[model samples]
Target: MSETSSSVLTRMGAAFGSMPPALWRLLLVLAVFLVGGIAGWIGRGVLAGPADVPTMSVYEDWHLLCPALKTKDGACEISQDVYEQRAGERLARIILAKEKDKSMVMYVTVPLQVLLEPGIGLKLGNDQVRVYQYKTCTEEGCLAVIPVDDQLLASLTKAQDAGIDVAQPNGKAAELPFSMKGYADAYGAFLNNEAKRKSWWRRLWS
Candidate 1:
């Protein structure tokens, strides 16, 4: 392997070696549960009728998902899932969607073992960290719905990485990091799709 690749592997090995065994087990379980939930979600969409089937497109690490047949409230979004490298388990899922008022919203879902009091911390690149409270928790996981204003959106577009921080039930802090490598491209495409959808709807009504 190249020297750079070897160096990266060394660092990753060291990091994983330092992680606690209990944490690893917890992450593995969480990953399995989350994946199953996602599968069920997709299955339901598939069974919802041919007109309501879901479609997904990939842009680097980000995915743009939308319904086959658009409805008045059917808005598309870009999402990414962060995984534990060692066990190949999902650590968290992040989604960005646009609202009717032209505002953006970020939905972060993490394992249910997180402490809800501290909420969830979002750090984009080197900027200040923002905390969003847990809006709800279901069988899948806990979700934090954060409103993304113009400033936040700008940061996201230019950011190279994002870190999501949450506290475990035992009060230990855990961070789920994901690359922003394709965020700009994915979001741009998402905007274009939204515009086209809106235009189509307008024409239909007119």
Candidate 2:
């Protein structure tokens, strides 16, 4: 070998000789791993194009469906003050339809495009959740019968805001906010109307 090559080899040999046998073996293994990784990375880059990365989205003031009796500009017009004023006064029940001889049931309407099988997710405030199955669907939308059970009524009384988790076919889900400002008052008034009030049923016949 040439003098320069021989000198480089001699220096390397001396350095390795000074290193512990275990350390030398470890370093050799590490060097091999690094070389293999680099080779694999280069090979992958040569074989494939850059990957498609998903983009994030940020929307400003997305319009939601109004849950109040009144709405303006796709938003609920009734504030907490208004809700308090008309809470019990506006409590009126409309019997959707009576089964052949079955009792009338209360119902809540939902928007179209909702998956009917899994039912709807109802979250009262930060906690207290329940799922109500769809009763039936019309051209307007689907209906969910709200049971006036003790727990549900109690939850509404303490809840400031409620959520309806709408299921989508694409696996992406969405939540709709429903203000429970005067829900308890209205529901209480409805409960007082025993003559009009009917047993809660899972399905609507009409």
Choose the strongest candidate by lDDT: 1
Which 10 consecutive residues of model 1 have the lowest summed lDDT?
Answer: 197-206
Model 2 CA lDDT for position 103: 39
lDDT scores of the candidates, listed in order: 0.87, 0.52
Task: State the local distance difference test value for candidate 1.
Answer: 0.87
Candidate 2 collision pairs: none
Residue 64 lDDT in model 1? Answer: 93
Location of the lowest summed lDDT over 10 successive residues in candidate 2: 73-82
lDDT tens digits by residue: candidate 1, 52-158: 45778899999999854456677888999999999998889999987777678998999998999999999999999998899999988999999988899899988
Query: In model 2, which regions exceed 4 Å deviation?
Result: 1-106, 188-206
Residue 110 lDDT, candidate 2, scale 0-100: 60
How do the residues 1-206 of candidate 2 rate in per-residue lDDT, one tens digit apiece?
A: 99999999999999989999899899999999999999988986787543423222211211111222121111111112111134433211112222333433335556677788888777888674678798888875676875555566566669877666767776677666555554554444333332222324211210
Error of 1 at 99 (Å): 3.8
